[model samples]
Target: MKNNWQLYVLILPAVIYFIVFNYFPLYGIQIAFKDYKAASGIAGSAWVGLKHFENFFNAYYFKRLLSNTLLLNVFNLLWSFPIPLILAIFLNQIKSPKRKRFIQTSIYVPYFISTVVLAGMLYIFLSPTSGIFNIMRTSLGMKAVDYMSEAAAFRTIYIISGVWQTAGWGTILYMASLAGVDTSLYEAAEIDGASIWQKIRYIDLPSLVSVAMMVFILDCGKLLSSNTDKALVMQTAGNIPTSDIIGVYVYNVGLGSGQFSYTAAIGLFVNLINFILIMSVNKLSKKVTDVGLF
Candidate 1:
């Protein structure tokens, strides 16, 4: 420990930053269990012993919130997560290096676009009045529809746009792992008269099991969350029923309404679920794969 002072010095700032910004605020977790009041502040707030959590659990909109959050998360996990793996495989198979780079670079640009801008773009394209989508619809002799305002289209747009924005960035790890596959394996498969599908299924796919398992397990931790920034920007009274997930709910009841104790309780519920899922998934990954991320 004494000999590693230089390395410790290099990491000291990050360590302190987490302590200051993350761990220190944990003291306010007590607010969730208290009938917090501005006059008394967090420390002096009267202890209420799970009242907020109880209220939230029994709230009229509880089912809606839970369903919406879970659906979005599951949709993302199933569709968005796997697209990157497919993309990486496709990119790896490209014979032309210049064309491959151009395609990869093009896909990656969407990930760098800010969430706010992405939402705005969706609005602009999906708006019924002047959006390109409606213009094309009307030109085709169909009624101009407000896609963003339709509850049914909310999840579709949200999930598809999320995939569009993130799938490329997500390819990085899979591509790296794919690059590490043994060239000898391919040569042997070639000699054996293996088809492309056979090579991918038996070789490349097996090589990705560890990485895929880890990514799947980690992604499960966010099953109760949604992209609050994008959701908030896209949310409208028309789409509120479908768009209101835990993150947006927390923002509304917590900061928007200033119900600190109630919001804290909701947040605590979210984090607790995430922690439990992470632990459970890690244990499952250990049983199913050679490498577990614990």
Candidate 2:
């Protein structure tokens, strides 16, 4: 232990980071059970026990929020989850280093775009009057559609844009796993006259099983959380039916309406839900595939 003091020194900053930023803020969680007031402050606030939680559960928007959040995340996962894996597999087959790097760079660039910028681009490109998408449709003898304002289109747009932005970045870990595959395996497969698809199915897909399970388990933790920034900016009066997700509702009610205690209770509820989800998924993954984040 004494000889490894320098190693401990290197980890001190990360330890302190979790302590300060993650653990310290837990003290405010008590506000969820109290009738918090700015004048009374957290310590002086009167305890309300489960009143806020009950109110949230019975609220008119309760079902809508829960459904919207779940549906959005579930659909997003269904559509976006497989693209990166497919991309990584095919990318591994690319023999031209130059072409692989170029394609990788092109796809990865969108991930660096800020949420706000991406939302703005969506609005510009989907504009019914001037947007290129609508322009092409109109040129083809079809009426223009205001896609951003269409409630039914919200999830589709969100999921598609999300994939375009982050699919390449998500491929990083899969690519790393593929990179570690022994060249001898490929040599043996080629000598056996195996096709690319056969090599990918038998070699690449099997190698990705553990990593894919971990990613899936982690994603399940966010089943009730949506990208509030993107959803908020893209929201319109017409799309409110589908776009009023729990995260946006929380932000609006919490900061916009200053319902501190109520929002705190909601946040705590969501955190508990996510925690349970992650734990359950991890256990299930372990039982089924012997791969888990823990």
For candidate 1, the TM-score is: 0.94
lDDT of each: 0.91, 0.95
Off by over 4 Å in 1: none
Q: Flag regions of model 2 displaced more than 4 Å.
A: none
**C-alpha lDDT of residue 129 in model 1:** 90
lDDT of 1: 0.91
List, residue by residue over 12-82, the lDDT tens digit for candidate 1.
99999999999999999999999999999888889999999999999999999999999988987899878
Q: Among these predicted structures, which one has the highest TM-score? A: 2
